[model samples]
Target chain A: MADYKNNTIPGLIGFFLLTYGLFFPSLSAEWVSFIIDRLQESMEIMDSGQLLIASFAYISRNALLYFLIYFSTLLIVSALTKNTDSIAFSFLFISATLTAVFLINEFYGESSSYAPHFFSLGLLLALNSYITKQRYYYLTFAVILFFLITAMQCLNLIPLLSQWSFGADDLAISLKTADSFITEDQLFTALYFVLFAIFFLIAVIFALLVHLFNIQITTLKRFQVQEKELKETRFALTESKVYEEIHSLVHDLKTPLVTVRGLISLIAMKYEKTEDKKLQDYLTRVDHSIDKMNEMISEILYENTKKEIDVDEFLRYVISHLVLDDQKIRLEMEVQENLPYIHVNKIRFARAIANLLENAIISFEGKAGFIQIDVKKVNDTVRFQIRDNGPGIKEELMQEIWKEGFSTKDSSGLGLSFVKRVVENHQGTIFVSSTPGSHTQMDIYLPVSSGQGGAFYDIDHR
Target chain B: MKKSSAVIGCFLAGLLLAASPFARPDSAASINSYPNLPAPIGEETILFTSAGQAPENLLLAKMAEDLHLEGDYRPRALASDLYDYRTLVIIVGNSPYGLQYRNKTFTEESDRIKQLLNEAELREVPVIILHVAGTKRQDNQTVELIETTAPYADYFLGLKSISSSTKIIESMDAANVPVTLVQDLEDLHTPLNSAFR
Candidate 1:
């Protein structure tokens, strides 16, 4: 459509040439008939009345023919070009050219009976353009102007045109005579003017309506865009406020843990020289548990505190966090030899994996179910696969499970969403596949750490 | 682009030059063919009208006045207009614009003319068919009108220069009606004057 509009000028030129080429001969024939009839009248072979009627008939026929040809050509050109603007422009150009020719003929002292007919044709062409392309104010103006011009020309009210005498060179004078005869019928003459006025009013009202409609649509689209932007800004503000509150709450938790750890160290020092080994060992285990808790707090408060941990060691930490006391559920683990270490926040990464295991165990609802964990290296990353034979997640609920506050069970729905956040923060990816009423599997890939330490590095927890 | 424009201009010029001759009216000498029988005459108070509502009725009306023929001119005269009329002179030609201005379709016009002709036949009013606009008025619709009105017409008058004058002559000959083919509208004055008185 844009391309068609862009080429409108060229298209107009082409159509103008086509219209002139097609109608030239018909116009010429009308002129020639008028001249011949006048000559016959001079020879006393035909009377003035017959000459006048013949001239009127020939011009009227040509006018009707030209109207048909112009209308059909516009339709065909519009169809071929798929451009109404171009066709309307072409029609206007041709109509103007015809009007110019009529005016030029009149100025040269030749009275053309077909001049008003051609002007009327121009009025019709303008009306067509106004109706089809009402958005263009120029076309509406053209319609109004053409209608007035046609009325003036038809009524012989044009001061300059009325001064000219009917010459033998042009046959269109007979049309002027016919108009005089028609005007003698007062009702018909009034009705004709009324019709033209009505059409002009209709064109003006329609153009105004179209203009208002376009403005309304533009305003509506603008409001829609602003509404969408406001929604996104409000959502982002809410997310940031939640993160700020969580960070403040976690920072306050470190104070109490620090005092408890210092008191336990003091008690261990007092019992160091005594022969009480079991008590000493128990105290050491308590101190180590406090340290692990502190590490988890650090992981929550900050995201960048990460260290490399062996894949197998990470799996053991995850299992230790889960309670496997339920008899209806069984757990299995498989770790490939020489698996690459993954760089991640140990406490949060283990907690995310533990949440998955807990969800799997809960899915059993006290029914017998088996959960299997597999760790292996592929390319530059380590993958963990956790499979469970239980009531699997439905296809529709799979994506929803990872959204905050979305859950199908009687629990806070933050488990999967938290897991997804932790994995994404560590630049890892998680995927899930499930068969409803059968089994479910989850795969997590974490990029391997560049550093290599002892093959069996351990983190103690009591 | 300039070359293409020039070529198209040349092509269009050739077409215009080629079509100029065809656009001119036939320049051959007019032929006047009359039947052997004397022209039929009708009483005064003739009804001058049009068969297909052409503007030619106005011209014919003027011609009737010039010939001192007393008649009423009704371009869209209905069958009821035939009251007390002794002769019906209908100018036969079709103008699409004329029909449109009068808010009539070809079918309605044809039916109206048929009704008027039928009323004339019942009233025994002498009907004369005139085809005066020459070949410019000859079309399928006008030809059909002529054919439909021929059988009821008592006399046929038309121009000799029109190409379809042959068809009009043929229809009149087939209907066994006397037809007068004249050189121009002026020549129709003599025959028309004779027919009225």
Candidate 2:
């Protein structure tokens, strides 16, 4: 697990250059022996220890020559480009040029059998990139390219080579031998076969290594993502605990307020026909204020409890409460027939709808306006569009509508924001679109119930 | 890099000169090694046994097949009757240890081979003589057989040690026949193919 990312392209090139310097000598020597024997058309050159030594010396010199060139190139590239991608581009250019030169020389009888080495070099380059970026696809691409190059080189073996002058007698014998096979070119044939075997083995090993490595990397990445998600969820859970305490406190306050409202009602009912009618009117206002407070408190406490309810019944209940409070605004509701039960907090959902209706009523500003609530089952979810024909919100204020404590009118700006929060808590979404003087539409979506047991509300169920 | 390459090049050139006597540019001909082997005389060839009993004629035929040479191997046929053959291959050795010729005695076989060589010489068919049986065939009788038949051959292909004897070497030199000496029995195909070619 050394970090290849920190390794620069020039350094990688230098490393490969060092590798070539160490290993290419033997390969080059073998190639030289093959070339000498092929030219002689006899094994005399191969048998002569002197020729082998000369070949080894010659190949080593050449290897030394190229290695120095590459090493200097690496040094220059690293010095100039440093850790930049330009070095990779330059190195690839150099490698491609070198590979082409070597291959041409191999085919032209200066040498033979550099393909497997080039293949290995290419695999190393690709593997370097893959390891640095942890991108398995790069390795996959390299493997494919390696096979393609090998196959192409194998096909190149089909042609007869530019042969050696093996005396006239050796040439005649070689030609006779050549007549029986597809190509009389034994050198090309031998080189490609050996190269293919070596490359094939290398490809299999590299593929296995890449495959296993990719699987490990993918699994590791997936685990890291899941761990991050778990951490975020745990943090959110801790934060939600604070809201639960506040909701409990609000729930507790409702009991005393209800008792106080009952006492105020008794006082107002006893003095209904009294001369002090002002007191009676004030008590009635207090009762109405208490009722609003209770509704707000119930909305706050409406967390984590859900029940399956008929869509039509739920819409009717919300509409009944709205119509009783304001008979001036015309309220219209349309529910699709045979709609499935939705799993959600009925009270909270109703409060959210009620808030929308209240906003629509206030938009009318005592002038008659129409509010339409449309409910239907679409796919696996229930959709509700609450549209109002009041003076629509300006486009400038639209984006700010969902912001907490943001309002265009004189009031506490928590109603629409709270509605959005409640809708989101039920795994649902609400969208709004409006045009000035035309209409404003609020569309809400909630997932339909799967008929599993939920935290049922007795009042809603009954 | 340039300096290192120069130093390495000088060292390698020095090593090359030190290791090979023929490393001199003018000695290029020495590197080609024994350039006077017989040229191939087209595909019309026949592998004819001189001693008549060397069962290796079949083996040489298989070798011909392996070398991709188109030829017929007839151990008992008269060379004069082979009008279509361009070349005659005479295997000049006797098989021992239950592998000898049953049809003729050593004298009869040698006479028959002498007749075959005369017929081949008259017909102007190039003859390739192979003394591949090594030391086993260099007995006094076999030497006599070789002396009679080998001087008629255009090429002498055999083991180096077997051909190194003063008599055969002198005979080869006198006949102006080029000798291609192989190391072992299986190595005969190189020289064989060279003769056929």
For model 2, residues A335-394, the per-residue Cα lDDT tens digits are 899998887677888888899988998888888878998999777778898998999988
Per-prediction TM-score, chain B alone? 0.81, 0.72
User: All models: lDDT?
Assistant: 0.63, 0.57
In the order shown, the candidates' DockQ scores are 0.03, 0.03
Backbone clashes in model 1: 1
lDDT of 2 at A138: 34
Native contacts retained by candidate 2: 0.00
Error of 1 at B18 (Å): 27
Q: Lowest summed-lDDT stretch of 10 residues in model 1 chain A?
A: A453-462
Q: Candidate 2 residues B1-197, lDDT tens each? A: 33233234433443443334223234222222243355664346565554534432344555666777767767676756568777778776553211221435666677778888888888888887767544323445557767887678887777654543556666776777777776655677776776555
Docking class of 2: incorrect
The 10-residue segment of model 2 chain B with minimum total lDDT is B24-33
* Runs with alpha carbons beyond 4 Å of true place in candidate 2: A1-205, A239-243, A262-274, A295-347, A350-383, A386-462, B1-126, B129-197
